[model samples]
Target: MKGLLVFFFIFILIGPIVADVPVREEQFIYSIMAFNGRDYSRTFCGENSDTIYLIADQDNFITTSKTLVYYWPITGDWKTDTRSLNYSFEGTLELTEKRRESRIIYPERYTFYNVKGEYEQNWKVAMGDEADKAWQHYQGLIDEYWQATYQYEQAKMAFDLMVDELAMKITEMRNDGIDVTGLVEKLKRLGPPESPKPPDDYIVPPMPVQSAFILNLPRGEYNICFINEDSAVMESSEKRVVVFEKRRADGIGFEVIPGDKWTRPVESKRSSSVLYVNGTTDLYLRPFFQDEYNDLYYQRMIRNDAKGNPSLMNWVYIQQVPGGRIEVTKNNHTSAILVEEPFYVEQTKGSALGYKIVPFDPEGAHKDRDPSLIAFKIPITRETSLIKFELLDNSGLNMAGSSRQVRVIIKSRWQPILLVLCLLPLLVMTVVRMIRSRKYSL
Candidate 1:
C-alpha cells in the first residue's frame, strides 16, 4: 500500500521528534535570590516548596545546592537548574528576627544610558553615599582604559613594521632606476596608526564577590536557618521568609509604550483598567512606582509556585517617577499638560513607505541623539475618543495611583457595511448555482 503509506508518514514525523527528549531529575533545591531595587531576583525552591520572597530593605541570597531538575516543554515550566549538579551547602542564613545582617564588599556597577535608535544597556548598583566614591572612580577609569589599550597595541605593531619596511625600500629603489619621487612622497605621508580613544564611559566593573546575604530587615515574618559545616540544621535548609511591605506606597504604575508597538509594553494597572486604544498611532507613557500584592502573598514571596492565586491582586513595579506632568483629559472638557517630549522617527520617502513621528530638536535635529522616551506624545485623533490620565507631582500634586482610561476605537464608515454583508452569502451561493445549471439543461 505504497510502502504502508510511507511507513505511516514516517511514524507521524518521528512522533514529535521522539517527544522532545528532556526528562532529567536529581533534586535538592533552594537557590534563592531577592535584591530587587535593581538586581538579584530569582527565588525558585521546589521540593514541596514553601514561602521565600524578600525586599523589606533589600539584599538577599541563599544557598543549598544538589541540582538537575528538567521537564520544560517550552515554559510549561521547570528546566535549567543543573549547575553541573551543584552540591554546595556550607551556609549561614539564620534569621528569625535576630537580624544583624551585613557582609558588604561591593564593586559591580553598570548603568549606561543613551538609546534613541534602540539597544541601550543597563546594570546599575551604586546606591547611596556615592557608592564608594563611585566605585573608586569607576575602577580608576577601568585601569586607565586598560593601560591605554596596551599602548595602542604596541603603537599599532610598530606602525605596521615601519610600513612594511618602507614598501621594501621603495621597491628596491625603483629597480635601481633611482627616481623615488621623494620616497613616494614619504610613503604617502606615513598614514595608518590612529586607534587609542576609548575611555568615554567605559564599564567593566563587577568583581569582589562573596555573593550576598545582607538583609537590612524591618517588615516582619521570618524563619530562614541554614548553618551547616557541622553546626548542623541543613537537610532541606529551612525557609519561610516573607518580609514584604508596600501594599500602597504612592501607587501610579503605567509603562504603556506603543509607538506602533515598541516591543509590546502595555501595563496600566487599574484605575479600573479600560485601555482599548487604536485611534491610529504614537503613545509611550512609562510612569511607575506601584505596589498592591496578595496574589497568594506575591506568589509565595516570588516563587515556590504552587500556582499562586490566594484571592488574586498583584501589581509590584516600584520605581521610575521622575518629575511627572501628564494631565491629558479630553471628553471631560479638553485639558492637555504633557511635558517630556523629544520624538524623531522619520523614515518615509516614497512608494507608500510610512513612519513619521518628528519633534526632537535638542538644539536642532537630534544634536547628539538619545531621547526616544521620557514621553507623553499620544496624538491619535479620528473620533471615538475618551482619553483621560493625570499624574502631576513636581509640586502640582495629584499622583496617587495616577488616574487612567483610554478607549479610542474610531473605525466606522458603516464599517464597509460588514464587508457587504460578508459578500452577500457568497453572492447568493453563486447565483443559485447558476440557476440550477440552466434549469437542468432545459
Candidate 2:
C-alpha cells in the first residue's frame, strides 16, 4: 500500500510535465509610456492588472495594444509577445474623475534622447513637431553614415590593392640588392581608410503608431477607458488611474558594491547605513539623489502590479550629484577625499568569483580593459571604527542633506567558542574546590 501511494504521488507530479500545455493566452493590454518621477519609460498592464498608477504632476502616457500575453511560471510574472502579435487600437482615451469631471485625450507624439552635458539630469523629451524634427535628424544621420560607409568600402579596396603592389615592388628591390629604404618608409606611412561611425543609440527611434494619451494631473483618483469610433466605452480597456507623488524629495543615496561580493551590492537607500563586515573592505559607491514614495504606489507606477508594502516608503533614484566629491571621514576627524574615477573589475578564474577592483589607466596595458564602474572608492580597515561620508561640490561646500554615517561592526570568527573551551578546566577546578570545602565542613 505504501509503494502504491508513492507511485501515485510520482504520477501526479509528472503529469503536467509529460503533457503538452499552452501557457500563452491572447489579451488586449494597456501599454504605458510612464513618467517614473524622473523620465518617461515603457511599462504595461496585462489582463492581470485592473489599475494603472503614475507619479502625480507629471506627463504620463498610455496606449492600448492587443498582443499575446503569457504567464512565466519561473518568475511568476506576466509577459507579452509584442513583436509578432502586436495590434494597436485606434481610439481616444477618456478620463472621468468622481463622475463629475470628464476629459477626452488624443494621442500625442513624444521622443527622448540623452543630452551630452549633465547626462543624468538632462534626458530631454521632445514632443509634437520637436519629436518629428529629432527623428528626422536621426534618420538623416543614418543615411549619411550609410553613404560614408559605402565610400570607405570602395576606397579601402583600392588602398589594399596599392598596398599589395607596393609590397611586391619592395620584395623585387630587395631581391635585386637595391637600397629600398625610402620605398619601405613610404609604404609604412600608408594607412587604411577610417571606418564610418554610427549615431548614438540613446537617441530613441520614434514610433508613430505607438501614440499614447499623456496625463499630467495632480494627486487624485480617476477612471480611464478607451473610446472607439462607435461611441462605445472599452470595458476591457478600462483601468483605475492612481496619480501619486513622492513623500521625501531629493535625498542622497548610495549603491555600495563591495570588492569581494560584486553581484550582491548593498543599497544604502538613505545616505547612512551600518555596515557589518569582517576585517577590511573596498566599496564602489555610486551616489544619486532620490525621493521617497509609497512602496506600493511607486511599484504600481513603474510595473504592472504593486508588489511591496503599502505603508513603507521606497526611494526612487533620480540623478547623480553634479560635480561633487565624496568626503569619507574616519572616526569623525581624519578624512579622505575620494574623487569619481573609472575603475575596472578584473575577474581571475572562471566561475571562481574573484574580482580585483583597480583604477583604470588608459595609457598602459589596462587601456584595453573597459571600466566596470565609475564611482567613489571608500576603503575600510580594522583600525577604522566609524565612517562618515558626505557629498561636496567643487567650491568645497557640503551638499545639504547629503551627509551619512556608517558604524562598522567587525565580526570575530570562532573566538568566543575557543575561549569557552579553554576555560573548561578552570571551571571544573572551581567546582571541585567548592565540593571539597563543603565535604570537609560537613
| lDDT (Cα, tens digit) per residue for candidate 1, span 1-442 | 9999999999999898886767667766776665544345576675556567666875455556768777677666665466567776655666665355633222222222221221122344443444466566767767887888888789888888988888899899899988888988888898766676755553335333334345556677777766666767666656677786666655787888777766578788776787888777767787877777666766555555636676777777756777688888877888888877767776768898666667787887788887665677767664738888878988887776688878788666898899999899999999999999989995
lDDT tens digits, residue span 1-442, model 2: 9999999999999997895544777787898777787676677898778888888877777778789888766676678887769988788989989757788998888766655555454565667888788778777878899999999999999899999999999999999999999999989999999989876655344443235777888888998889987889865888888888889998887877887886788777765456656536777788888899889988877777549788899888887776689888988798889899888777776877577888888888487668788888888777877888888878988877678766667566968998999999999999999999999995
For TM-score, the strongest prediction is: 2
Report clash pairs, candidate 1.
66-87, 252-401
At residue 411, give the lDDT of candidate 2.
Answer: 60
Best by lDDT: 2
**Any idea what lDDT model 2 has?**
0.80
Question: Which ten residues in a row are the worst by lDDT in model 1?
Answer: 111-120
Give the TM-score comparing model 1 with the true structure, all chains together: 0.31
RMSD versus native structure for model 1: 28.9
